[model samples]
Target: MKKNIESIFKAHLEPKEVYKGGKNIPPSDKKIYKLSSNENPLGASPKAVAAMKAALEHIDIYPDQTDMRLREALVKDFDGKLSAEQFLCGNSGSEIIDIILRAFINEGDEVIYSNPCFLPYSVFSRWYGAKTIDIPLLSPNYDLDVEGILNAITEHTKIIFLTSPNNPTGTYIPKSLLDDFLERVPKNILIVFDEVYRHFADAEDYVTALPYVLAGHNVLGLNSFSKTYGLAGQRIGYAYTTPTIANYIRLIQKPFLLPLTSIEAAIGALNDSEFIEKTVQTVLDGRKYLAQAFDNIGIKYWPSQANFFIIDPPLPEMEFTDRMMEEGIMVRPVSQFGAPGKVRITIGNQEANEACVKALLKIKS
Candidate 1:
């Protein structure tokens, strides 16, 4: 009798939905403005590009398994608030989430997060056979419902994922609410704060989870080089937590998680303060310009502290997306994010922003 491979790996073979991201635009003759993914308007830092070129000469040599050089750069970048030992670098913020899940989650355990969050949290949890609890965000503003999250907690709850300046919605949890929530959360449960868009946030009350991690709480602050550093192509990110948690993650992660070019690029990007400043300022300025344009055009959009904002278009969500594509502009329709009838638009450079606005104006007319 032939053995059934599907039956043999039944647990792993279970049909689960894969996560989807922004739509990609194929090569074309027309000028395409890809404002779909929330990427930096400015390209990669020149210093980082130079470093990546230099690293190519030594591509034959293996990278340091411990990622000591990159960690040291992070230490200086954060002004010693976190030590080298407290950081764990990974391929990207998404991979760091997977690593944490692998390190702690067990079959049938529970994970809690807001509905319409970064889709990977639920996708990854289900892959590990963890039951994901989706707590609904308060409507109108899309702020996290802390009380709802607290009420959903059970003994089986292992991890709680929180995204500040959250994707699609572009809303952040205020410090006051987070502090209160932290005090009430059980010490046994781990809190993962996804702050990949931190650099773009300028809210006075907005703060990263570093303070909680520094206070010895079971918290991890996840950051990425993708947005602010404009190193999305390099696929590198990091997480900072207590030494105990960092050490635990280090145990399960494979050696040389990143290539030399990526590490060197991140380090070089860190050293380029001028480029970083320009990127942030440009995003902020473009955000304001877009907001004013939307208001003038009589379109409703949520205020955003991150690099992107969600807009309720005059047409259907997918219809709006298709229309934008026809105009050589790619925007994301976030119905899968539990945000039906809404479209997410990245704040691009001046020219790109103008092009997007012009396309929207044409659609409206």
Candidate 2:
């Protein structure tokens, strides 16, 4: 007897497509530049690399279940306002997203987020049988519509997920706007701030929600080492909140949450401020260069505070992506994020950025 898998998933049958990027192209004589995933072009820090190499020797032993040492190193970076007990390290920031939903969301609960924001918010909300309330972004800029979001809230609303320098759009919530929002929002509801791109943001008015967490609000700050430390492969990140909430998340998390290598690598990354500075500086410089190139070519693109930007090309977005790949450049077609006719490109190294601009200009001509 054949069992219907769709029937098993029931309403969840419509699978959410998780966009995978940074795939290695086949070896060729021509140079290939990967500008698809918003990875640090500077690559993993030397300290992280050294830490991983040292960890390999101790693979025979089990890692610390609580990730104590790594958490201790991270505590100092937060300037001692956040204690180590308030932090929980996971495989990735995305994993923490899933963990948060599992630990908090009940069936039929409501989770609100903006459309064209992080895809995972909707995807995982639905996966947990929670109703996903998607508010559309404000037009012309694709920024969050705080009023609309506040209007969508009800008694069933359990969580609110917000991303700064939102994925695919590169737009951020303003400080004053967020301050107003936090005050207006219900104090009982949990608010999650996904600041995975915080290190790359240089906008003068762009602010982080960590202050809320420190001020005894029901807020959680989620971050990853993948983008800033170039530790994507290492698969380690952290979530910061009140010790009360932290204890609950920790209780539900699977034991042996992160491997020894990931823990050590993360510790090494937190200790290497010089490398982080260099990576951020390179992306900042490359972002400016790409913006200028796009302007000179008359291509419409978002001026981003993140390591990536979305641009509307002359051709269809996917067609533009194909042409880019054919020219030995890889970028993300962001129609999946509800923005059709636009492609998102990561800010690569100077050489890669120049090559990508040349390819894009060639395709336009």
lDDT tens per residue, model 1, 117-164: 788998998888898999979998998999899999999999999999
The numbered model that scores best in lDDT is 1
Candidate 2 collision pairs: none
Cα TM-score per model: 0.98, 0.95
lDDT of 2 by residue, 1-365 (tens): 89886667657536667745446666888888989888889999999899999999999998887777877887898888889999988898888999999998888899998867778888888888899998988889987889999999999999999889888899898899889899999988999998999988988889886888888889999999999999998888898999898988888878778999998889888889999999999999999999999999988998898999998888888788888989999898877776877888999999999999999889888
Task: Give me the displacement of residue 59 in model 2, in angstroms.
Answer: 0.4
Error in Å for residue 9 of model 2: 5.6
Best by TM-score: 1
356: Cα error in model 1, Å: 0.8
What overall lDDT goes with each candidate model?
0.92, 0.88
lDDT of 1 at 217: 93
For candidate 2, give the lDDT of residue 187: 89
For model 1, the superposed segments whose C-alpha errors exceed 4 Å read 10-13
